[model samples]
Target chain A: MTSWIAGVDVGGGGIRVQVRTDDVGLKARDRGPVPRIAGAIDTSRLCGRIGELINSVVESGARPAFERIAVGLTGMPGLVRPAELADQLRLHVKTSSVVVASDSVTTHLGALGGEAGCVVSAGTGAIALGTDHRSTWNRADGWGYLLGDEGGGGWIGTQGIRAALRFHDRRDGGSEALLRKVEHQFGGVSAALAAIYNSPSPIHSAATLAPLVADAAHEDDPVARAIWVEAGRLLAESAFAAARGLPQTYSWGGRLFDAGELLLGPFRDEVLKRSPDAEIRPPQGQAADGALLLAARGIPAGAIAEPYVHEFA
Target chain B: MTSWIAGVDVGGGGIRVQVRTDDVGLKARDRGPVPRIAGAIDTSRLCGRIGELINSVVESGARPAFERIAVGLTGMPGLVRPAELADQLRLHVKTSSVVVASDSVTTHLGALGGEAGCVVSAGTGAIALGTDHRSTWNRADGWGYLLGDEGGGGWIGTQGIRAALRFHDRRDGGSEALLRKVEHQFGGVSAALAAIYNSPSPIHSAATLAPLVADAAHEDDPVARAIWVEAGRLLAESAFAAARGLPQTYSWGGRLFDAGELLLGPFRDEVLKRSPDAEIRPPQGQAADGALLLAARGIPAGAIAEPYVHEFA
Candidate 1:
């Protein structure tokens, strides 16, 4: 009997799963995130959903138990007990071992393909992690929207909206192009402001407007372009800061990089500017692929132990 | 019987009423703000509360109808219709005429003593209004905490906390003093951050930490002091911007100015730096006092007509 391995990427948007056995592989996604109860990961529900996703991805045959499973979760650190989550998974899926890690770790592995390097992942927020997966674990930013996440989507969107409002108010540094876009999207700046304030997740609200900024930047809007340029620089700074004791090899993962040269141009410029010998590479895969790699191959040599990467046998 | 006048200041903190008749004046306060329903002021509840406070401020006797009553409301501009509010006020208080003005207008009246100058009011938020009361109405930087309100208490507190978080993250520009204070106040920076994010009024939560920044600045913490300096400079810029085409005479209102030299020093420096002949005067009274002045003396000479200041007889 061929053994199967499963990988799960749990994020704010939803849950994605990958299954592999022999040379065949399959992927599936659930449009709902693991329900969090009062700041905690609902382990039972998460395991149940992970089981459903894994089953859906596997070919229709006699239901086969997975040999191992790995999960990269958004709110993993300090929010979930790995041992308990592993135990819960045992009840839902037939797996001999379970691995749990922060999405940052998975992102790092996915970006650098388990090689020692720095990876800055920016989506709704931004965080950089540098590790040899053995002893070093340097982190930068990811402080959320209020305090940090500086060069992330939330930051870029906020700057864009603020510039729009500046134009609306006829203040200096206002951008007419951005203002027109914002007015079209939110009816007016005041209404947009009100919507942001009243939003349950204000960070996401701000981040949702990031594409508008990118679009404006692409159109040669000076203020919007400046915002992206600054964002790239700030993200590079975070990468370098995280890369302190690590090698000068850097990469990035996350949808923010989807803007292509708009972000990469400045990000690459700053990284090389900071360290002339630095190497910048495109990501190998994604968080789910990294998680699947962990499940299929087990922990790589020099990978950090418990707390960062936990295993239950 | 000599006619009496009433002035009510409705703010986020609460409502305060001042009643004047003959040579005596009485004051009373209600610690609860006017109830808001679906983003609109509950005029009925507000009028009921205003009536109770007004009656409380008058000596126990036969209630004499007021000749005029002026209200300075925090959310008057768009949240409440002045005529509707006036009709509501008439039902609660036997007044022949009612005056309703934005807190900005009243703050201007109080700070400049009805003069044609500029006043910047900084509290939980900040705003600047410059009007001749007859024609000019140049306003600047009241865009709330999200977009504007730079240099306001909320802005100061946010910058302070951000520095603290940077320290916690071991990032550049971090302040040890601020980190220590934040940890002391909120047990930990992460906890403090969670609280702020979970707060219904995140701006107020940030503003509440302004005193900590102020204290740290007083202790000569460079980061905290720099924040205040920038804040003062920003406020001054707003003041000067509003003062455009008007007299360079300027004054300030709101408890934020109570920081005294810490704020006033940089504020005055920036104001003078922007305009050599600018005059910085101490505020003559509070917002309520301006509302009272409006009620007693009616609109000042050359004071701009309706919308800015409304009178229903």
Candidate 2:
């Protein structure tokens, strides 16, 4: 018997939630800001918010009770302890079982359904996850803004800002088109720096400029195109590393959705260079969709995935 | 005959000042943290402090009246406005002539003895400066810690910390020896993160660990050695760009002194590859000495080098 389930993508500013039921299929519910970062998560605050969200969904008669739930914390294993978080969240939501995992896991599950494949999620940060037919998963990179996050939206945006400043100063590696675009977007270099410094999330603030870079790429600006080319290569290389030569199919996911062949062209070339037979496909749905699959027991969570979201009590 | 003059390396934490006389050669007067970055400089406060320093030196019989003074502001040309700063300071100091320049220019001057050559100063940030025989100067990198500054102490330290974290997690590209060294250095990963997040100058805090990386390299840790190799190459490439293929000499300065050949070997090789006759030599004096040269009119501050430190009184 099919029953109700929910999937949540808890982010720094807010949480995006999706509810799925046998009769209703899948629908988005209310979204509210959670604490932030898988690592900086305030468990009590998050659990309380989860409880409120579940109550609102049920009180409004979205469903009588959720049979299962899945949560993809932005930083799962490294930042948030899946088992502990699952237990805390269970007390608030009515669920017989819950699956908790990294947002990367949800991305993979959502993009590939129950099929074996790799999903490379590139937003403010970038990470790659792959699973075999047996649902065993391997993950790579997402080292945040400093150490790594190569080729992600934030990386691109940062490069755009830096290049713009250099170009404005008539410094080397400066591009006129890029400088104009970044100046227009940021209202000037100092403003851009100010915004980044004053903002609560510098990474996300920078990521917002990725589109300007993407636009620059469209114009065939060599500087802009270079960033994308490097990004695509890095992303593909990282995703391939996670997949370990198994399940030759891959999906690209994240805010930099379908940057067209600009990103995909290099990504595809990089992947095919190694695997030759590798296929790059677009994800069918978002991470929430994958979370639903985990909730419905259509796929099992790996060791890092934390299959059980419900509290024992 | 040289008159009493002062040269100051206005640093982030404190001011390193040298009171120079025709007879004394070079004498360090006092040092106290002034400000961190160029943007953070408080003109009034700095000028007041400078006034006090001059008074202290005179009162202690170090000097009678300063005939000339040169101040090498850490981020003068880029982050700090040279003319405006010089004008503000002149109102407070007793000097007929004063010169102001980026610390990089002074670093080059001090290292090259007012001759045409390149100086790579890699401390909290990295920058290279070079001048042709005609005194036309060019600068490379030093784009601050965020944009660039590769091969600087801050960069090496940051790399060391990142490698340590990755190794601790047994993540991809981790080195066991590096991890052990990092853990011992920071007391643990959590402590390291705390130090970075809680510090006023995260960049400086990270830079503090560069010594640890050097130690690791001393023990032949692959990860630590790789960072130095990369750093050496980057510093050389940047210095080459600034030199414009003219000067065949280079002076490497900063806290990375203890790193020895682990850094200099690759740096020398890279520089020599570009300029086969290039000579790498130890710096004859510090930036303060360069400032003294500026004060004595021993070297003309290029158009790029603002040659006035006097405030419009």
Best by DockQ: 1
Candidate closest to the true structure, highest lDDT: 1
DockQ of each: 0.46, 0.24
Tens digit per residue, CA lDDT, model 2, B230-285: 89988898887777756578896766755788888999999998788888999988
Write down the RMSD of all candidates, one decimal each.
Answer: 2.8, 4.9
Sliding window of 10 residues with minimal summed lDDT for model 2 chain B: B304-313
For candidate 1, write residues B122-235 as lDDT tens digits: 998888888888889888878777667989999998899888877766667779999999999999876888788778767889899999999999999999999999999988
> Which residue pairs collide, candidate 1?
A133-A304, B133-B303, B133-B304, B134-B303, B134-B304
* Cα shift from native, residue A19, model 1 (Å): 1.2
Q: What share of the true interface contacts does candidate 2 keep?
A: 0.11
lDDT of 2 at B7: 78
